[model samples]
Target: MSRNKGGRPPKNEGQKIKQAHLRLTEDQHKKLMQLEDQIGLNRTDLFIKRVLENQDFIITKDVLIQLAKVGAEMGKVGSNINQLAKHANTIIKNHQLPPEIVAQYNDLLGLHLVQERELYKVLRQMYRVMKN
Candidate 1:
């Protein structure tokens, strides 16, 4: 029986209300109830607000694809480093090379491996930010 400022009944009341049932884990339900209390609204009102304001939600597909590509490149880099390490290990096992050469190869492998790891960390951080 709510009336608008113009003394007319609200147009929306006559509209049909749709009901839906959802299941959630106990922890999730508790969190939802806490969010409702924090927002001064029930869960239904919160869902409505979320639907209305979903423009703020981010689902960056392109960024995700780019991250996948970066991951693939990182994997290739890792594979290359792995092959190099295996080759060096084989040489060490064969003992065909001088100690100084083996030491140099080990140093080079360590540098490349560390650089690859750092690059992977950066890529992971970028992916997290984009996906969040």
Candidate 2:
């Protein structure tokens, strides 16, 4: 802790200062100004308060427990997918394959790729929202 001129510990003594300029759309600017008028706080103070609120702080030990639970569910889904691919390979091996089956598999893989790309787009949008 850093001491002030009177030798008392200073609040937020070691905190880093932020110096980034943010751009807002005209509509967003108008809305934020309206909020500022109603709340009696300037844009800077309101923005800082919102940024602080958006920070993810650990509330309890159970937070990690919840994350682990979700991770396990994802693992199960991955394992199931792997098992499905293995079963499909086995079927391909056991059959005198027609071209249609191969085409269907290729189409399914393409669909998965498209879905993955869309998912990434959505996730990027969510991250942008969080940052803003």
Candidate 3:
């Protein structure tokens, strides 16, 4: 029978023998802990991924949770806006809507649509981040 050496195999790239010492404030430490919990990476691995892999830690899990809640509330507001627009259209058909009210309603609806689009874009970005 043949005997073999029992250690890690040699790496094609040079060994990672260097280390870095960094300072952290209270907020920074808290965020690092949050990232460890969310991404299942220790501080060292997180730093390595950030520095070597060029990964961006823009949104944390907690921030995404809060944003999701706000998005849900905004979704309800959007439903109400649609209902109001429908009622205004009915009033216009009956010639009961004033020109000033009609103009303001149009303006408000346009702004609401823009805001809703922005919200969806944010949600999409959050989804992409979580997926990766």
lDDT for each of the candidates?
0.69, 0.65, 0.80
How do the predictions measure up, each by TM-score? 0.38, 0.40, 0.60
How well is each residue in 2-119 modelled by candidate 3, as lDDT tens digits? 8897998877676677789989999998988987898676777778768876778546567768887997898898798889889988988887888898789889888988988998
Q: What is the descending lDDT order?
A: 3, 1, 2
Q: How close is candidate 3 to the true structure, as a TM-score?
A: 0.60
Instruction: Return the lDDT, model 3, position 72.
Output: 86
Candidate 2 per-residue C-alpha lDDT over 22-78 given as tens digits, one digit per residue, 9 for 90 to 100: 799999889978777665657665666567656332122354466468557756756
Global lDDT of model 2: 0.65
* Worst window of 10 by summed lDDT in candidate 3: 55-64
Which candidate achieves the best TM-score against the true structure? 3
TM-score of 1: 0.38
- What are the per-model C-alpha RMSD values against the true structure? 13.4, 10.3, 5.2
